[model samples]
Target: MITDGAAMGRKSVGKEYPSHGSVLGGKPNRCVIHPLQSSMVAEALERRNKDWIVRTKDATDLIVQVGDFSFHLHKLAMVSKSGYLRRLAFAERSGEENGSSLKIILEDLPGGTKSFELVVSFCYGGKIDVTATNIAPLYCAATFLEMTEDLQQGNLISKTEAFLSYLMLSSWKDTFQILKSCESVSSWSKELLIVKRCSDAIAWKACIDPKAFATLEEDEAFCLTLLANSHGNLNVEESSEKWWFEDVSTLRIDHFVQVIESIKSRGMKSELVGSCIAHWTVKWFSRITSGFDNLTPKHLAQKLQRITIESLIKMLPMEKNSVSCNFLLHLLKLGLTKQINSEALSKLERRIAFMLEECSVQDLLVKNYGSKDTTYDVGIIIRVVKTYALFALKYSEPRVCIVGRLMDGYLPLIAKDTNLTVDDFKSLAEALPTNARYSDDNLYKAMDMYLLAHPNLTEEERTNVCGAMQYHRLSQDARQHVMKNDRLPLKIVREFMLLEQVKMARSITACESNDHPRTKTRTIMKVTKGLDRGCLTPKREISMIRKEVENMKMQLDQLQTCKVKLQRQVKRCIK
Candidate 1:
């Protein structure tokens, strides 16, 4: 119970309406006025009455003790401003009516008396001073009491905590300071649920406050603890990071799992615990596959643990283009490690096998070999092809053949691609397997284009492009053009001179061999003559000839495509 003896002290809040009829310092009421002057005095009294209902503290109902400070606040003012207070007021009304007490003790209230006083001010005048030091406590206290803004301003529900976090993200030093400070606050994620609310804010300021990571790095326990904390009433899709796990995997796995077990002993909602564990485990495994992006909301939901395999099957990518290869790899790892076992693991294996068979040949190449959009490391594309080629050698009729052809075809195009640098091509060369080298290697073609472009292969000051490709092999014509002296080998000169003698010997040998025709083999003959040669009358041979012609036409088309791509490379070199 609080004594009302502070009434006299409360009256000195501010300048008040001095006695209605008195002069300065309560001197006297002897001054008189005419009817016109009297009317003005009456109007002044009316104005004062209209304003004094809240200001005149003649009937304060509650004394809110915040730390060492006390606020003499109206019961209606506090109740209307806070849902928690309204409940307390209702419960205490009978006790107050029996004259027990008019005080509300806020034991260990967050934000101290000044911040609460600001709350009181807002209740009275709709204004409160907000600063970095006080803003956090103000928000936490408001959140604790479920205090909402005035509904007349159009807010439909009470969630001042989220709004406060949202506002905190806008400033530079403040956002970083708040994020670092809040991490050590103990059970903030489990109890306060600030992680999701502040995630985007933290990301935006990571650049501005590079040391923002120092807090988490110095305190590994804090990051792991955040992962294990159970959540409720969470907005699952609040973050749609294109690659969320890439950031989340910064947390240490062994320490994170240990922290999770400790928190689980204290009792967490099973669903939340399961979801957190599954997602974190998936992210941990994603690091090995280098496919953290495969675990984000773009591919899998956070609540995947709660969903059945049947639902997951529907959600999983049926086509190779849609396949989260890393995710399936994670499931297989989970099975082998016995992290997931029994029927679930069996089903997972089946799903993976089906995905492997149904996967798009083209898409699998892009996913593993590195495509332009998703792959960040320049050389991953090369290794992707190399690995695929290795996988093919084990099978006599291997699907790796598809990858093999693509590897050969894409090498020159990718090496000469304007998007990639010569250093990138060098990395590719380093990783490329020796056996996979011969087919359509672009290493030489790239240098040839460069040598041709500069006019004087000797003219340039040796760019990274020149330094990398200088020793690469080139064609006879390109070598002779200007880069190298035209020199014919002795063997080639001798062979050229003996061509007529070889032709005569081959003609005599052919005449002797054709003396006895064999029945085992079919020989093609050029049988056109004026009046001596006879034609082979058969539609079957005609069809075979057409088939050969068509095959040659297809080969010609592919050659033309390669020619066009080579031209584009040359243009890029000139540019």
Candidate 2:
């Protein structure tokens, strides 16, 4: 009976259970097993008598140990099909301790223990159900065991080679399956050129229309596995040009990189390639951040993430806007967190700066998690904004204004954090040119929020913080708020007060100009129109004069309103 390596025991084979024979005649039939079904399959194999161990051990003359698994077999059964085993058997026979079983330890077997189990089964004339998932490792294990045709006809090496060729040429999904499977025995797969061949096949399929290839029944199962791996985020519909991305992204870094290089060599568009890199970053980094990879050690996972981000940066397309500005900012953020190389971080910063107008305030609000006494990574934003300001010189004024307002809107949010230093706040406020913001309402609001949060600022520091604001550009509402605010330094308040007086004086002069003598005379003539109709009685004249007096009183009330505004300004100035 067959069983897992972890539950090996002696059992007799029964004729009732049929073997899914080798790929020599026809493709093997096997169902994909879930973890629970894998155990079920093991139990079924045990009951059916396809033993992981040989049927009898009394005549066994050979023991092969791979990792924690041991296989007992007759020397004749093993030596006839394996050159390496034959040599080991001969060496054992020639030694002084020849009476004991010939023991061979494969410490670094290509596919580890389970794959070696398959090799042992093949040596015993058992069926080998080779599929895409096991093909690479099994082929490598067979190669390592030297199970070549020279040792026996229709041997493992020849059979697996044929299977590999057929699978690579059969369909798109099979080629990817082979490539992904190679990740288990990565170095050996590369050494045997399995990775290269599969990468080329995938690249060729990806470069042309995928409709040319057959979408066999197995591909549905393969796509479902990808969908599960990606947490149901991957769309594997044939209509999507990126149906292959989810499958390709499942590969480890080295294998994935090789496949990408192959695709690039086939002249795929840089934008599409960049998009793939972005997708991979989102998928894998989310895995790292979400803490789903519990099997991997923390430090090792971090190391892998660092490598992933660094490789992605190097793989980014040089074309402008190939990726969104938000993505570049995200990479820069992770790059900072991972402490990646400064050169790469610098590249991300510059790329972000080049497209800074596309960014929003929230995008730049990367929280500070370091020794810096700030609520956010204000320094990173400062650097990015400074670089963007320099780049803005060549662009249109509207674009510069966009970044300007983005920063303006960002300042108030960061200013509320008591830990944020005044210097960082001031640097961000003044990062753009004076003309970047056509109005300083938001900036003034930000300054007020900062001053309120940090009340211990020295007068000079307050002056420096307030210097970035242009009082004249402030909206009237902002101007009024500032005029009433007591947190502002006395010097700024006094300067703004002087400007307010000048503004009030200009307003009064304009009002007086509109009240010219001609206007007053016209108003009186309209009120006395009944006198011209010959109803010039004393009582009527008296009522007409009273109406003129009421008109004059209304004009006085308008002047009184202006006077009240001046008085309030004077009171604020005194404070």
Best by TM-score: 2
Model 2 over residues 1-575: C-alpha lDDT tens digits? 22322112222221111112111122332211111111001111111233245664345566777776666666776777778878877876643275777778779888897787777666654555667778889889889889776766667776677667766765455566677778778889999999888888878877775344435564454434434543345355532456566657767777778888899899887777777787777877777768786878978877887887888888787877678776777788788888888898888888888777777777676565566467677778888888877777787778788988888888988898888887888888998987788899889989999999999999898988898887789997887676667798866875665455445434434455464746545543454443353456534444454444444446656877888888899999999
Task: Give me the candidate number with maximum lDDT.
Answer: 2
| Residue ranges of candidate 1 with Cα displaced over 4 Å | 1-143, 146-320, 323-398, 414-423, 434-438, 441-447, 450-575
lDDT for each of the candidates?
0.40, 0.69
Candidate 2 regions exceeding 4 Å error are 1-58, 74-76, 86-97, 171-180, 205-239, 357-379, 387-402, 412-423, 433-442, 445-464, 470-487, 496-575
**lDDT digits (tens) for residues 313-402 of candidate 1:** 333433343435445544444344333335555565555433443344342332223464322233434434344444445644434334
lDDT of 2: 0.69
